[model samples]
Target chain A: MFLPMVLNSLNPLLKETFVNELLKCNERTKDYGLVLTPEGAESIIEARNNILNSLGRVDMGIEVALGLIENFYTSTFINEENYVSVLNEFQEIFYYMKNETEDMISDDKLICIIKDYYENLCGGSLELLKSCLEEFIHDFRRKAHTAEAGLGGEE
Target chain B: MEQRDNSGQTLAVQSKINSTNLKKSQYTIALLNESFRVGLMSREEINNIQIQIMQILKELIARYTKGESSSVCAYTAESILNSILYCIDAYALGCDSPEEAICHLKSLQISKLYERGVKSVSRWLEEARELYKKVRKNKLNVGLESYDHTINEDIPLYFTNCGIVFDAHNGAASIDYQLTFDDMSINGILYMKNYLEHLWIENAFCKYFNSEDIEKLLSDFGRTIGMDYKIELINIFELVFNNAVFAILAGIPEGLRISQYHFDLLSGKLKALDDSEIDKYICQTVEKLVKNMNICELNILDYIYRYKTVFTQRVIRLVRIDSLRGIILTEKEEIKKGYTILFENGKEMKIEDFNLFIKKLMKLKNTEDKIALIKSGIESLNDFVDLLASDCLFGKEFEALFNELGDMELAILAKMALYEEIRSDFRGLRSVISEKKESRVEWHICFVEFLKKSGIDRIESIERLLGEIDYTEISFY
Candidate 1:
C-alpha cells in the first residue's frame, strides 16, 4: 500500500498502472508477520474510535501528538550497564522525589541526570531530541529523492 | 465429601500462566520501544535491529558521551526518530498515520530499544535454572561463590513484597525499575519457586507411591556388590536431575515405552554397580551396613530375618514393609506374603500374626502389658523348644514335635468321620493309632486346623483305645 502511494507521488504515469492493483491488494491487507491484515486494520480503527470517544481527543490532529515517542526514550531511560551505580546516586539526590517502589530506583535521580546532562552536555538535549524527530518526513523525502537518482543511475 | 476433578483446575492454571508469560514478554518489548522513539535509539538489546539504528546514532553520541560535538548528518538520524515518534503518538491515540510508517520498520525485523529495566525476565529464569544445576554439580550446597559481592545474590527478600502502583501522574518513566515478577512472567524467582514446588509435589507423590521408584531403581539395578557412599550417591542424583530434566525422565521401574525402559536400564546399571566399579552412587541405601559386607537380597526384612546377627551387629533398623527401596540381590518375591514359624514344641506362629501383634502393641494404651504377654508366649514356647533342642529319645523325638498331645490329636482326627475308628488326638495314643484319617493333603491340614479351632483339649476316645493297647505308662499331656 505504501509502495504504490510513493510511486504514484513520484510519477503520475505510474498511478494509472500500480495504484489500482495496490489498492486491491490492500483491501485483503494480509501478510504473515507484517500484521497489515484486514483483521489488524479493523482492530486499529476500533481502538482509535474508542480512544477518540473516551478521551475526547477526536479533534486532536495526528501531528499534535506525534512527537512524544522521541521525548520518552532518550530522556527518560537509564542505560542498563551503568544503572546500578548511577541509579544509587540518582536515588540519593532525588530521595525526596521517590515513591515507595522508586526507593530502589529514584525518580529524582532521573530528573537530576537529565538536568545534569542539560547543564554539562551539548547537542542531544530533549530539545534537540524533539527537533530531530520533527525533521523526520522532510529528511525522508530528501532520502527518497536521492534514492530515485541512484535508481536512474543504475538504469 | 464430593470429589471435584481438580485436575482440570490445575491444567487451567497452567494455561493461564503460559498466556501471562507471553503477555509479559510482549509488554516488556513495547516498554523498550518507547525509549527508541526518541531522537537516538537508546543502547538496549545490542543484537536488535532497532538498536542497530541507534548504533549508527551512537556514532553521533560518542562525541556527546566524550564531551565533543562531532559533525554528523543531522537529518539522517533526526527524521527516523521524528517519523517514529510521530507514528508512535498517533498509534497511541489510535491514529494509523505514523504507525503505518513505524510498522514498516518493525515488519522489516526492526525492534525499538528499551532501557535495561525492561528486560526479559525469562532469560534470568533460564540462567538461574542453569546455575542451580551447575552449583549442585559443583557441590556448592547453598552458598554462591566466585570473587564474592555478587550483583545478583537472590532478591532483597525483606523488600520483596511490593505493591504495584502505576501512578499516571508520574507518567510511564516511574515504571523503569519497579521490579515485578508477574506471576505469569517466566522470571527466575517464579521458576525457582516452581522448581521447589514441583520438587515438593513430586516428593509427596513419591511418598504415596511408597517410593516405588526406590524399589524400581533397585530392581532395575538388579544385584550390586560392595559399599556405596552417601556423597557419591548425591552426586549421582545431581547428575540424574541435571540430565533427566523432566519428571517423565524418571519413570516406572518397568515401562512399555522403549525410551523409559532404556532409562530404567541405565539407572539400574548405575544403582546396582559393584563396589569394584564405583564407591557411592548418590543414594543413601544401608549406611549402617559394612562397606565390604556381603549384603545380598536387598529386601530389608528378609535380610533382617536371614542375617539378623549381621543386621543387629550393624544397626537396629526397621525395613518398612510396603515402601521398600533397597539395593538387594534380587526382587523380593514375598516380602508381604508372610511366613509361618513352626516351633519344635508343636506351635506355629504365622508371619502375618507377628506383624499384626507388633502393630497392635504400637496402638495399645498399655504397651508394657501387651509386650509382656507377647514375651511370655514366646518364652514358654522357646523353653519347650530348648528342651527338645537338647536331646532325641522322644519317639520322644516324635514326642518333642507332636508332644504327648500329638498322639491324642491323631486319634481324634482319625475317628472324626468313622463309625468305629481307632485313631486318637492324644499325643501318647496317636502313636499307636492305626485307622487312616483324611488322605488329601489339604484335608489333613484342615483337619489339624479344625482340631485347634474346635478348642477340644483332649481326645478321650483315642485315650481309651491306647489304654487297651497296654500303653498304660504313656499319658496324654
Candidate 2:
C-alpha cells in the first residue's frame, strides 16, 4: 500500500528515467541482433489493470510480472509490429489463469510456467502457449471440483 | 383529563373519566405500540411522540384549570393515533420539519383517518418493503440482467428502506442512480415499487412458458431492450412490470392473443393467494398502474409500444372482444356472405357481381364491361365501389382490384365509397371495415405517388402492379 503511493509520488521522475533506460537498452541489445523495442509499455499497463480489476488485487507482484513479460518478449520471436497485441493476449491469459487457480498459484509461479512452456514445449508459439494456459485452468478447475466433492459441497 | 371552565367550574373529560372525571391517557400509549408493530413508528421515536401528545393534553388541562381558556377539546385514542400517523407520513414525505408536517397534517379535511392513514399507509409501506427485499435479495437468485441481456455489465440492484427506492448502475459511464419516487404521491411510489415485484413475478411466469416463446417475445421487444437503445432503468422496469401483470392476469399464449392454455398456468402460480383477494388485488393494482401512467408526466410510450402485443392481448382478453384491427386480417380469409345492396330501383345485387367484376378487372379481360359500366354512368360505378368498400378483399386482392381500375377517377371514387358511405344496420362492422379500407386506400395512394415520382406516370393499372410488389418492397424513401 505504501509502496504504490510512494512510487506514484516519484512516478514522473521514474517514468523519464525508465523510458530513457529502456531506449538505451534497446540500442545496446540491437548489437546482439534481437528485434525488441520499447513499444510494449502500454501493453504492460493494460495487463496490470486487467489483473488488478479482475482479481481485486493490489500491485504486489505487478512489476516483477511486467519484468517477466519484457524478458519473454525481448528473447522471443515477437517483433515491434505484433508485440503489443501479443502482450495483451498474454495478459488476458494471465488474468484468466489467476482467477481460475483462485490465486493459489503466485504470479512468479505463473510467469515461470509460461516461460518454460514458451522455450521448451511451445517453441515460441503463442497459440501453443494459450493451449497450455487453458490446460492449466482445466486442471485447476478439476482439482477444485474434486476437493468440493470430497468436502460434500456444491458449487 | 380534568379541566375547569372559564367560570371556574370543573368539567368532566370524555373517554371514560374516573373519580373527578379525569380522562385517561392509557389508550394513547397503546396506539403508539400498535403503530410500532405496524412499522409506522420506530421504537426509539414512539415514546417521544406519545409523551409529546400527552404534553399537549396536559397544557390544555392546565390552561382550563387556571381559567385562561374557555373550553377544552376531547380527543379519543383513535383520533390521536390518526393525527400521529398523518404526521409520520407527511414527515416521511420530506417535510421541512416534523413540526411543520404535523401542523400541515392538522389542516387536512380527513373524515376517516383510520382507513386513510393507519390501514392504507401501513399496507403500502409493507408491500414496498417486501418488493424492495425481493428485488435486492431475490430469493430465486435470478438477476434483472437475466431478461435484459443488453445489460452487459453485472450491476448489483440496490434498494433502501426509505420506501421502494431502487438504485441501478446505468451501463453508461458506470453511474449509480435511483429512479426517484415522489414520496408525496402515493401512486408514484407504488408505481415504482410494483416494478420490482413484477420482476419476480416474471421469473415465475417464465417457468410455464417455453424457452422459444420467451425468445420470440424478447426479440419482438428487442428494439427497447437491445444494446443500442438506452432506455432509462425505470422505463425498463415499467415494461417488465406491465408484461408481468398482463401475463398473470391473462396469460398470452400467442402473438397479440390471450389463449386459455396459459390461464391455468397463472392460476396455478397464484393458487397460494385467497381467491377473492386475487380479483380485488388485480383490479386495484391494474387501476393504480394505469392511473399513475395517466396522471403523471412520465412517458411510458416506448414501454407500451415494445410490449404492445401483450398489452393489447390482455385488454382484448379482459374485454372479450377482437379489435377493428383484428377484423382486417379476418377479412382476408373469406367474403361476407350476406352483404347484398339494394339499388335505387329496388333491385338487390349479390356481392358475387362485384367479385366477378373485380376478377375481370384483374385479368384485364373486360374492356366491354368498363364500356357498359360507363354507358350506365356514375350509378353503376357507385354500386361497384360500394361493394368494394365493404372490406371484402384481402390486402393483395384489394390492391389488385384497385389497380385494375385504370382510371384515377375510379380510384378516387373508391376512396369516397370506403370513407363516406354508411350502412346503418351493420354499423359497427361497417365502421371497422371502412376504417381498414381507408388505410388500404392510403397505401394505394402512397404507392401511386411513388410511381409518379419515379417517372412511371402513364402505366396501365398502376395499383395492380404496385399490389404485385410487396409492402416491404415498396419504399418511397
Q: Count clashing residue pairs per candidate.
A: 33, 2
Per-candidate local distance difference test: 0.30, 0.40
RMSD, every candidate, angstroms:
33.6, 26.2
Error of 1 at B21 (Å): 22
lDDT of 1 by residue, B1-477 (tens): 121122321111221122222222233234345424432223433135444334333443333224221211233224323323222222232312222222333333333322111132223344445654443333312111210112133222211321111110111111111111113332223334333333332222223222334443332222121111111122122212222221222432321112444445545554444542322332222232212223343332232233334322222121222111221222322223122222233353455664555455445445345435444544223333332232311222222234323443344333332312322122232332333355444333344443343323454444433222212222212
lDDT of 2 by residue, A117-142 (tens): 87788887889888987887898889
lDDT of 2 by residue, B6-45 (tens): 3444433233222221111222333344444544346555
Tell me the lDDT of model 1 at A155: 100
Which parts of model 2 are misplaced by more than 4 Å? A1-43, A46-89, A92-116, A131-155, B1-430, B433-477
Q: Say what the interface RMSD of candidate 2 is.
A: 34.2
